[model samples]
Target chain A: MRAPGGVGRRWAPVLAVLAVLQCFTLLLLGLGQSAHAGDRPRGCGQPLPVAGSAGFANAQAARRTNVNTYGAAAIVEQATASQAYSGDLASRFRSGEGHFRLTFNDTFGAARLLTLCDDRDPGDQQTVMGVDDRDRWLKKDRLYEQPLDLYATNVYVSGGAQAIGGFYSASVTQSVLGYRGAMVAGQVINLYPAFFAPAVGNWQRGDGVASYAVDWVAGGYLDLGAVAARVGTAGANGLFVTVDERAIGLFGTLSRGVGEAQADPLAYLRAGLQGFSLRRFGAPRLSEAIGQSSLFFRDMPVGVDPSGDAELSRLRTLHLDQRAIAQQVEAALSYRVGQQSGLYDVHLGWHTPGFYGERSDLKGSVEAEDEGFGIRVGMIDVAPRYSLGVQGGRYFSARAQLRGEAITGMILFNDPEQLALFPFATNALSLRLVVDLAAGG
Target chain B: MSRSPHRPQRPARPGRLSSRSLSWLTLAAGLGCTQEVAPDRFCQEAATAIAGRTEACTGDLDLADARYAAFYEAYTCVDVPVESMGEDTASPIAPQDRLHCAFAIRNLPCSLVEAYGDDIEQYMTASPICDTLVQPKGGAR
Candidate 1:
């Protein structure tokens, strides 16, 4: 006789893989190449229409919205800094080495900087930080000769369209760790200056407003700052200034209709390349450098769960303290195929490690939404390990869109001992009910 | 007190081209290979190239139209002579460099600008070759 629920447990992974493959097939079938070669609006000799003041204003507004929405996603400061700390920790400590490990993590608020207006009310600025501190000591020598390890990850994100003057967004992450005389520190700051906004105009698209703008980005990262501030008898403070004056970002948004149609955007895309000038002048102990290049694009139908897609994208890119300092590029495309009283939504995404590593993954999910009730199931493959998760929720009313969602997942194809070591990966469940009563329903 | 056995090793510095040197190289190239083209010829070539390339890539005539209009307005390409433009500005872009900027915009790969048609405009403004077309007063070559 088989063990109770053994068959169901074994079949879950197979079912998840099948569902993802089916979505991929559908996506490929739906892909269509646009053809409009013979269409030319005006002759080369004829002068083009001049954009009026109102046109310029509308374009600026569109630019501001796009910047506030997709700016933070362009910054990889937190991911880069966190990876530095994890790299240092992994190199020093090993699991099951008879070492006592104590860990503490506390997050004040959800870090929803990528899509600022999706979570909260539009124009509401939110600041959040998460701290994870870990300490390890030798268990055998309890009295003396205890090798102490202390490290902390701090992330700070703030900015919105409602910010003073023009729109502003900033993200900073600092990682510091000390093991005896050896100390390492890494900090990344992404700043969008108020004056960075450039003149933009909307391109007349018949029924929608489409605008694109490029902003000059100026920010620097301090990699391995004070790496060995106090090493042995010789102590020398080190500072790494990595400035990228030539950094530039491109943001674009397309929205259908006019006034009310402008409330929801149809497509959003942003791409940025930051080339840093690394200069080492003063006498310093040790330093490690950091650089980033990212491309983000999201196309989703209106009236669907935007926050859900954002959260899903965030979870896909959330590397924790495991991934190395490799370049990362992620893109998500969601489509609503059918709608009756309910809707069928399929999201397809692909993420690849940029510049540094050779690990890439494809993720897909299918969701059914009907009468304010929704359920989604998805899977993400991270090479040797993969996790399958199911999320279900419902909306109560229009003004008060109360949603109670519960997500549960487990690492199906991974080492049992590894799962035991990382308890969070083994059959984890989280439930949250959010109620928003903000103005303007 | 016994010292920890594993002292963290200093990470090796990554081998990457310095941005400062890259900027200098770009400036040197611009100065050494400055080309001179008539204003009318420059405008005609730029308009023809941008219109063909942008239309082929995006299939959106409105976007192509807007880009052409923006480019004309930026360089005063519509019935404006090269002598009158950038007269008061110091270190004006050499006539050949201006044409180079136009060609660069025209030659932008479809793969780079296909995702968003409007991005072509951004590339025109941000690209080192194209940005020199509208240089600020006393700007570097």
Candidate 2:
């Protein structure tokens, strides 16, 4: 079933008719070409052996050098209100993060496979040379002096081999400052990879893929790297370390042709399950608060001990000391015809307590000067997300996706009063648009 | 070898050949037909080879001899300029240098960077690759 570019899934029946018509048209075109050739099609006799052909060589060179530029602009609207400089409650808004990515892919070794199921054919081994740069600037509300900037570049070589029963693929990358997925200024999204430390802050990762057919493709991956956890001065003031800032994830997908191939608009129904566990251990460090440090504060308030006598004077920094594991399971029904694609899916996710909490400990009895300075390790819940993704275009590609998460947990609200005022976490609406500069129509 | 009695010998036409001569001629023709990779194909292969080496995992410095082969091949084919990093140079002739240089910058080991940095720097600074990014149509170096 194929529908108009960017059309929603509600028009599945129309798309099915269009897809059948398109296929018929393609069949007629193929028949005409064969009739004109006065012979059956056989890849025109292997492209006349490309070696020594200047035009062929030039085409190959062009493909190798082709650079695809991608521009993405996203705006996130959250339910929370901002209380920045003034105590006045201000409607908080997260506006723009403009990202530019340059991607170059070199294909060689074997002819490209048409589908993941092509692995069963054992004739379409391919090697891919990929490199990309992702750079972005995030604007946040009154938290830091400078806008948060992220720059990541990676070069990876991936090769896929079609073997008996299936195809196997593997790749190793040397990356410098690489971060993947949706990353917000103060938000950490679950279910992704982080690199191992000591490789370079840029981090390196390896991924493997196996596909027996379109219906059965599986992947497992791991990334290791220490992420810098900053404690704001209004809260705890210290630079702490994450002992286990690593992530490991596994995902599997199964898709099978559904309905009558010729009459039913539903072509394939697919489902995927993925789970990830991320753990970070932060070590406590000794630090001082205002009016407590004898060297820093010359005029101590009454009952304030410059000699560390006051219980509130000693503030030691401790992190949430958390191990978070989150799981996502989703099933999507897609309608595709021509070059247009539409997908509607039901997404379910489970998040453990401490998965989203960032807290620090106050070692002394005076209680940490910051009101929010402890961890809540007892909350967990499952939430459902409804999302729609549409993609259209032949050469230059455009993809728009919208996902809404029904809030089931108020993890961001710390104070009981605040929780009472805002019984649920703000509903999050994420919208993103990506434009590919080097697409062909 | 003796000719078969049942085979009647035909008169050779002018410029025609005996069996032995025909065999030699065919052999010569086949030898001359040895396939040579086209220039564009060579460049692509060179880039892929270079990328392969660049992506290979090396600890400290994988100084393995094979690793540099692709880099050297790319350097040779892409015509890396002898000019210094900031020196003005002509637009790069080999477009693959853009891809290869990106690999070097993003994935190359620090040890190899020390060895190859000068060349990579020179090429990237004068690279037409960057210029093509803004062009309505780009990719050709």
Candidate 3:
């Protein structure tokens, strides 16, 4: 199905868009420059945990688990192609030297960090994250640290079932030239692009079944809590703090992801039918100040109003309702005794939920076992929600694949895109493979 | 230019064919083939094969693979194509092909080789790839 007038050559102008963007970030990183006295922003905090080391201990781990369960990973569901990118950089391991995540509890207290935004853009981001390099291997070299005080939210650029590279947003990756953040450990995120079709996921609450969050003012106020997991021994624990943009709203979002155990399938399934919600709030001034420290992933704010203007109005950067907020989630469950595939994960979600006055939702998707992969289908019975999705990609090996659709409909209520020339659409496809770097002895 | 004190001295030239074999190589690798194969064996095997047979074969598409992440590793490697005209004159690469250069220059200045990638036809061209490119710091000295 071709759109109107000759669209083939129209793609001519698309060649350098990604490269130009890459360059823009490069220029921001200033790869060739040296450290300047006042060049980099100062927002780095202490390092986080990596592969071998337990990241969040008891209290921290538990707190993070709740956030994850309550839907933090879901924020990374949908992403766009314009910014869908992921990779990593590493310093060879020394006996004592290692890598880490630079996370700051405060904007100015510590060093630099990754600043990701879950903007109000209707649909345009594929991956808005900076992940640890894929090169880092356990006992070899991987990410040693994460950015401090970063705001990461997943958005659906194109809805898909597989979460290969869905979450999209930019983050400060490196420092200006020679100036490294004062924090000992460096920071980097592997911003890979996910490819898959979009549809309602597994679990879904009945229309208005889940209670919506309470309302709050758009100011310096933020909701935070600690998540702790058992670090090495019972003696210590790892900590992860969840930061949400708004205090309330009930909207669902979508993404294409795969995992040993999809983060939380039920959460995603529920969101697919009921989109998530967002109340507008401006990025913290400190968020920007912290970002200014590094050249990599350094993006200047393009503040504007919904009326197609750059005038900053309303308390929060812009008056955001239901349209602007979105999500991306990766959920999987992995136990040994794997039969067909070494690891099998029932990817239950990655959807945009309804947040504007709609009740929480109940949604579910089923992957029909067919060819090497399966036909992915899903539905939602949310009170009021509407979205579009199409995904096609490989979940595990290049041979074992998944290529088909399951759902595209208005789940519960009103969709804002009634009059737009084309309704919102999300599409994806990915072929994955595995390679052995080190020989098994 | 002054050499850095930390940089290792270049190794004396070894057998031209000193390279590793791709035996059932899966894709998850991140490093280019780092197996320490003796070049003599590789050259001998090639010499034994007929010239026609050699042309019919294309080298492995996977570079620096890790078993666990072969799929991801392949996705990460970029393929930048270029043409070598006769007498050292090279043609300007297509804009799409030049993306590797842009990527290497952008956000990843240090990984020019990884970002720019190997020419698709170079392996078949039978040029001394090992002799031309320097070994990355991780390889055996």
- Please tell me which predicted candidate would have the highest DockQ against the true structure: 2
Which candidate leads the pack in lDDT? 1
Q: Write the per-residue lDDT of candidate 3 for residues A1-441, one digit (tens) a residue.
A: 436643433323222332342353344223211111121111122222211111111112122222222222222222110011111110111111111111111011011111111111213223422333221111121111121111111112211222111121111211111222221222212122111112111111211101111100001111121111110100001111112111232222222123533332222221111122221123433322221110011011111111121122111011111111222222222211211112222223232221111111111111011112322222211110010111112222111122111111111111111101011111101111111010000
Can you give the TM-score per candidate against the true fold?
0.20, 0.18, 0.19
lDDT of 3 at A156: 20
Task: Looking at model 1 chain A, report the run of 10 residues with the lowest lDDT sum.
Answer: A108-117
Shares of reference contacts reproduced by the candidates, in order, are: 0.00, 0.00, 0.00
Global lDDT of model 1: 0.24
Those runs of model 3 whose alpha carbons end farther than 4 Å from true positions after fitting are A1-14, A31-441, B1-141
- Stretches of candidate 2 above 4 Å error? A1-211, A214-441, B1-38, B52-141
Clashes of 3: 167
lDDT of 2 by residue, B31-134 (tens): 11111122233333333322222323221112323333334433444323211122132643322233333333333344553455425323233233422322
Superpose all Cα atoms of candidate 2 onto the true structure and report the RMSD in Å to 1 decimal.
29.0
Model 2 chain A: ten consecutive residues of lowest lDDT: A68-77
What TM-scores result for chain A when each predicted structure is judged separately against the true chain A?
0.18, 0.17, 0.21
Using Cα atoms, each model's DockQ against the true complex is: 0.01, 0.02, 0.01
User: Model 1 in CAPRI terms: which quality?
Assistant: incorrect
lDDT of 2: 0.19
